[model samples]
Every structure is written in C-alpha cells, then in structure tokens.
Target: MKKQIYIVGLILFGLLSCVQKHTKDKIESNQSRIFHYNNEPYLIKGICYHPVPKGSDQRSFETIDQDLELMVEAGINTIRVYEPIDDIDVLDKINSAGLKVIIGFGYNQNGNYDILSGSFIDYVKKYIDHPSILMWELGNEYNYHPEWFNDDITNWYKALNESAALIQEIDKKHKVTTAHGELPDALALKMTDRIDVWGLNIYRWDNPSELFEQWEKVSEKPMYLSEAGGDSYMTITKQGYEEGFNEKAQADANAKILESIFNNREVCSGVTMFSFTDGWWKAGDTDTQDIGGWAPNSSGVPYDGTPNEEFWGIVDIDRNKKETYVVIKNKYKQTLTEY
Candidate 1:
C-alpha cells in the first residue's frame, strides 16, 4: 500500500510539472514592438465575441459549441472577450478548438471579481496556467469615461498601470493590454508604461490608414485594432448604399477596413472586428432588436452615420453568418497564406 501511494504521488507531481512547462512555453512577448508567441511573430486573426442572447442581458457560453465551430470556420485564431471567462471548461473547449483568448476585466462589477474589488487578481492567478490565455485586457475604451474616475482620466490610467504591474509580478509569461478608444495621446501613452500591448477601438470611417503613421510616432509598444467594424443598419442613405438593415454597407466598410489593416501589418499587429454576433440588449428592449445605439468616432460607419448597435455582429443573433463574416473569413485566411 505504501509503494502504491508513493507511485501515485510521483504521477501527480509529473502532471503538475507538465502543466507548468506548458504554460511557460506559450508565453506572449513583445520584441521591439512586435508581438511574438513562443518567440515567433504572431499576427492576431481575431474577433470580439459577446453572445448575449435575445431576451437576456447576461453573457453566456451555452452556444459555445456552435460558436466555436463558426469561429474555426472563419479562420479566427483569437477571441477578445469583454469579461473574464468564469468557466474552465469553456477555456478548455476554446483551446481544443485552436483558439486563444484575450480576457478583459471590468473596473467594477458589483463586487464580482472586478478591478475595484481587488478580486480581479484572483481570477488572473487562477487562470495563469491556462494555455488558452493570450493577454489580460484591463478595460475596454475606459478613457472615454473619465466621469467614473473622479472626473479625470489620469486617475484611471494610474490604476490601469498598477493593475498591469501586479499582473506582471504574478505571471511573467503572458502580456497585459487595454482597449483604448482610438489612438492614445502622448500623455496617455506615457502613463501606461506597464502595458505590454495597446488596443485601439478605432472607427475612423472606412479608412484608418492615417492612424498607422500617427501611432508609430508616439509609442514602441505593440498595438492591435481592438474594435474596428461597421454595424448592419444604416440610418440614412448617404453613400449609394440604401438605409435600414443594410448588410452591404457593413460588408463594404469592413472590407475596406480590413484591407487597410492587413496592408499596414508592419505597424499594426492585426484587428479583432467589433463583434461576432449582434446584441439585442444594447439599445432598448432585450427581447427585440433595437436600431439606435451610439459609439464614439463612428461617423465612418458606412452609409449611415449612426451605429445601430444591435446589428454590429458579423453573425446575427441566431448565428447566421452576415455578409461581413465572409469578408472577414477571406481576409483572415488570406493573411494566413501571406504569412
């Protein structure tokens, strides 16, 4: 009996060692402002995903199997979530499907493991060894909301840098990033020294080409388009495309946007289009699709100047592929071919 117990202990020790090595080997690094995975350049072919079903404001992975299948079909190698995944099984499923995740943490979520609560680090330490993790995203476009940070954006930046520093102290393997709205000013860049990568949620109409040179002048950290895409609904017919649930406008704008992104792979790492599916919960009633939701710097949102938040998904609520989905798949796959 004693011999058997010792053998079991040895087996357990070996399994733990393997987990540690696997986690360490998959570290993400920035070498001279270029993102590298396992020491090789990794251009992210990613999409923002938040599948909150109609009639519910809560995020869920109940349709994960189908979602993963569609994501794999689109040649998507990474997923950007607005919140940290609470389920290990979901992370395992995502890993098995050959996808990595950039997990975002909110500032405050009613004491449910948020930055303000200081419990966000708990989730970080728990998932530190998970192979599917690509980066820990601190916030999404929080710069636009200084009201939450005592009427000053600088305070938020300080907290962001501190959180990032803590994560680096705990997990030296993965990098930390934040989703800033558009290009960061010189001051914002200076304040976020601990950030490994910068994510820009840009919507400068269909042409974001000017941003590449602009970004190169400011910082040397890696950057990716954390959110860049158009919604399906056009409020007014301005650019030859008709208004009202126009998928063509979205597809066309996304095509141009993607072309610009891929064309400037030298400076920009890659893009994770605004979303994977439409959210019925954004504008009005959660049970029905709403037409009016707003986003900053979204005047370039195709024929319509307004962003109908419910229609931004590359896939509809039911998981039907929108025209933009094909546009993304082609561009993403072509990128794979080029590399």
Candidate 2:
C-alpha cells in the first residue's frame, strides 16, 4: 500500500512538471507586425474570441486553452477581447499558448459605455507590461451611440485622447487603438492623434479595396481589420454542399475580404476575423441584439439566422469547423508566410 501511494505521488509530480513546462514552452516572445518587435512585419491573423461552454455561460479555462490551441494551429497569432478578463492566469495561459492579446478598455464587458462609469487607466495599468499584450483598444463602436460624440465630438475625442495618453504613459511599448462601426467625422479623426492603430469593424460585403481607399484619404496611420465577418448563409442547400446553411457564402465573403487585405498590403496591417465561436448568449430569448447581461439562452439552439448575431463565428460553439474555418485557415497560412 505504501508503494502504491508513492507511485501515485510520483504521477502527480510528473503531471505538475508537464503542466509547467507546457505553459513555459507556449509563452513565446513575438513582436507585432505593425509595432515591429524587431522590424519584422507581423501580419495579424486574429480572432474576436469569447467562448463559454456550450451549456453554460460561464467561461471554462480548459475550453479556453482548447480553443486557443486550435487557433494557434489555425495560424491565428492574436486574440482580441472587448475588455479585460477577471482571471489573470487565463491571460498568462494565452501568452503561454504562443498567442498575443489586444485588450479593449471599454465600459461594461461589451461595447456600450459612459466614460466616467469605468476606470480605463486602471485597466491599462493592469496588463501594460505583460508580454502577450499587443495593443490597448479604446471603445468598441462609439459611432453607434450618438451620445458618445453627438454634435460636439468633444466627448469622444476627450475620452480617447485622455485614455490613450494614460496608456502610453504607463506602457510606451504597446500601441493604442479605437474601433468605429464605420468612419468617424473629421473632428473626431483630428482628435485621434494619440491613437496608434485605426480599427474598423465593418460588415459591408462590397469591395474591400474601396474601403481601404476611403480610409487612406483620412488616416495614414497603420490599420487592421479588427472585426469583419458576415452572418450565416442559411439557405437549406447550395451547389454540392448541403449543410442546410450556406456556410460557403460565409467562406467566400471571408476569403474575399482577406484577399482584399492582402492586395492592399501596403496600407493594411492585419485581419482579426470577427469571431472564433458563435456565442448563443447574444440571441437572448428572441432573435434580437443582446442588450441584457451576458448569459446563455435557456434553449440550446444551433444558429439558423433567426438571430444573426449567434452565427458570426468561424467555428460553432462545439469548436467544430464552419466552412469559414477552412477558408480562414488557408488565407492566414498563406498571407502571413508567403507575403
């Protein structure tokens, strides 16, 4: 019995050692393409990742690791979250997985915010020196809220400039960015002098080149496809594919936009494909925008377009590949290496 106990102890010790080594091996020192770790162009293949368990809304560390490993395999180097996470170790684990992170210092867990309601500076200070950090994002889509800028545009710029100044003051090493649903006005654009990267979260399926051309006219700064993807193309069946949903359309759209990014490589910094997993929590009870707290719907329903919000993912909740998964993997693998 004593010998058996000794063997079990040894096994536990081995497991612990393996865990430590794995984490260390995964945490790599990679410089950004835009920021230039060593003047190397870092083509950002990122994902807007927020994965909770299928049945529950609570995020599982095990699932996070699993999803991240898959992302790394998919050639995704970065993961952008809307806000700082509650778990510090999870962020560490993300770094250990050889992936970079861009934390958005926004109000609440999601996009909407009142600048005074939260502490943006403290948020920046928390992860300023962390190795995995790539950029500090300010506000998600302030253009959607008229109150954020209104007629004056001062409310928006003041928050961006103030928060950005604080971030740079805390960590001169990292970059600061702001996301707009579309484009900001001239005054707001003029006030964005403090920001390093200009983020555009667009859904227009038109020619991406035209979009980049429009951007170049206003801001010559480095920019990225922070959040750009389409809803599920659910049409029962099309061509040889028969998933009831037209994932091929999604695949085509994602591929085209990425192709456009590559074609406009001189100006485009990188791409963060809208999402990793389809968060059902966004669907709420009916098919509507998620204004409520982040909670999984009581019903475990697969995305079909009733609520388009739940279908903007490369993979489903189970981490199974949607057609866009292969499209993204191929696009990322080719662009970052070949280009």
Candidate 3:
C-alpha cells in the first residue's frame, strides 16, 4: 500500500510539471509570431461595442454565442470590445466562434487616459495565450481628448511604444493599434514602429476623402475606420450643428467614403459601421449626435420610444433589418468580389 501511494504521488508530480512547462513555453515563445489566419495576411472586418460592461449587463455564455453568430452571419470576422477584464469568458466564446478580437484597455471617467499606468500590460500577460486576440488596442479614442493636445504628442507616442513593447514581450504575434476619435493629427505623430495600423472613428460630417489622403501621406501602415455611421438624424443642413445632422445625409456620406476607400485600396484596409442597434444614451450626450436613439412615430405622438432618426443601426433595436443593411451588404459583397 505504501509503494502504490508513492507511485501515485510521483505520477501526479510529473503531470503538474508538464502543465507548468506548457505554460512556460507559451510565455517564452512571446517573441515568436503565432497569430495568423487563412494562410494570408488578413484585415479585420469588425464592429465596436461595450457589450458587457461591469455592473451593467452580465452577458451569459449563450448570449455571447448568439451575438457572435449574428456577427458571422453579417459577414463580419472581427469583434472589438472594451474592457476585456470584465468579460473574459465571453471573449473566449468570441474566439471559439472563430472571430478575431481587438481588445481595449485603460478607460477612465474623463476619457483621457494612458497605457502607461501599466495595468493594461499586466492584464495582457494573463490572457496573451489566447489565440483569438488579433491585436491590442491601448485605449479607445484616447487621443481625441483635448488633454492630449496639451502635452507633447511624443508623450503619447512614447506611452504607446512602451505599452506595445510590453505586449510584444508577452505575445509578439498580435499587432498593436490605437483607436483615434477623428483626430487626423494623431496619425501624424512619430510612432509608426510602435503601432501597426491606424483605427479611426469617422463621423458622417467629416471629410472622409481628405482624411484618407492625409493619413496616406503620413503613414505607410494600413488604416481602418473602426467606427463610421449615418446617424438617423444626419442631414446636409445639420452638417455643422451638433444636433442637426440627418441620417440620409449620413448614409450618402458613408457610401462616398466607402467608395473612396475601396477605390483607393492601397491605403485603406476596411470600414466598420459604428453600431448594430440603438442602445442606451443619456440626455445631453454631446460626444456624438445621438441619431440611433430615435425612431419614427407609430402613434399620434411625433416621436415614440421606437428608434428615432439618430439611431444609426443597420437593424432597429428590435432587430428588424433596415434599408441601410441592404446597402451595406451589397457594397461589401461587391468590394470583396472585386478585391
């Protein structure tokens, strides 16, 4: 009996050693590139969302799977989410669904933050082993804060470089990108080696053609519009006003921008619409025109709780496909086939 017990202990020790070695090998191989798909260099076609925020919606595994199925059915291969720490299990589900993830970090209440905090680097070390992650987003549109302009832009670059180096140290296979909130000047910064691509959130009012040209002149790396939209209220007259923009105008702008980007394929990688549904928006949300929040009137009231003009979803909050969905689908199909 004593001999048998000793033998069992020895076997258990060996198994634990193998597990530890496997984990160690993964970390040591960080300098090596392991993230690739389809045997060809692929660009992610994705959507942006805060689907599972802490203390808000705790998305069940089933909910995550269903959402991924919808994205895949929509021909989207990438899903960008903020706060990976909040919903790691959902992230695993996203990976299992064969979707590439652009995970975000460093969100503060003021919206001006940095990866220099090193908290983001620590988080990367934990799950850098996951094969589903295609890239690390230091933060979402953090550069657009006016505070960034106060300091030397080099500071931002240095922060990005350092954070990126740390991530590479843990997993060199993934790329690092910054999500710029419509600040074309941010693209002009000297951080090309630190960043692999430019992620822009372009609103309908911006001059897409001009911005594309400007980015092309500044950076050799590829660019992607992580957020673009025709808010329901986007209109030509509201072009300059904060709240006056109309959806039709936004849609028209989207087509033109997509056409320019697709035609000038050398500079742009791909474009993703801002959202799929009209979600929660607080009163006086000035950061963006809340076009996705309103819907046409079904009752005598001029407006109902139904999605109003500002709601830019390709589908209504109820999941009914909109006219914009057809347009986007047809355009994407044409572009894919042509390319």
Question: Top model by TM-score, which number?
Answer: 1
lDDT of 2 at 18: 94
lDDT of 3 by residue, 100-202 (tens): 7777776442332336456776667767777677778876666645375455655666666677777777676677777776645644455647666667776
Q: Candidate 1: which stretches are off by over 4 Å?
A: 1-31, 337-339
- Give TM per candidate: 0.89, 0.76, 0.67
The best candidate by lDDT is 1
The C-alpha local distance difference test score for the whole of candidate 2 amounts to 0.69
What Cα-based lDDT does every candidate model obtain?
0.88, 0.69, 0.57
Give each prediction's root-mean-square deviation over alpha carbons.
13.5, 14.1, 17.3
User: What tens digits encode model 2's per-residue C-alpha lDDT throughout 202-265?
Assistant: 6655246777788768776778878876556443443343554567767876787888877776
Displacement of the residue 174 alpha carbon in candidate 3, Å: 0.4
In model 1, what lDDT does residue 215 have? 85
Q: Compute the lDDT for candidate 1.
A: 0.88
Residue 293 in model 1: lDDT: 84
> Backbone clashes in each candidate structure, one number apiece?
1, 4, 19
RMSD of 2: 14.1
| Cα distance off (Å), candidate 2, residue 81 | 0.4
Sorted on lDDT, highest at the top, how do the candidates line up? 1, 2, 3
* Residue 292, candidate 2: alpha-carbon lDDT: 24
State in Å the error of residue 113, model 2: 12
Comparing 2 with 3 on lDDT, the higher-scoring candidate is: 2
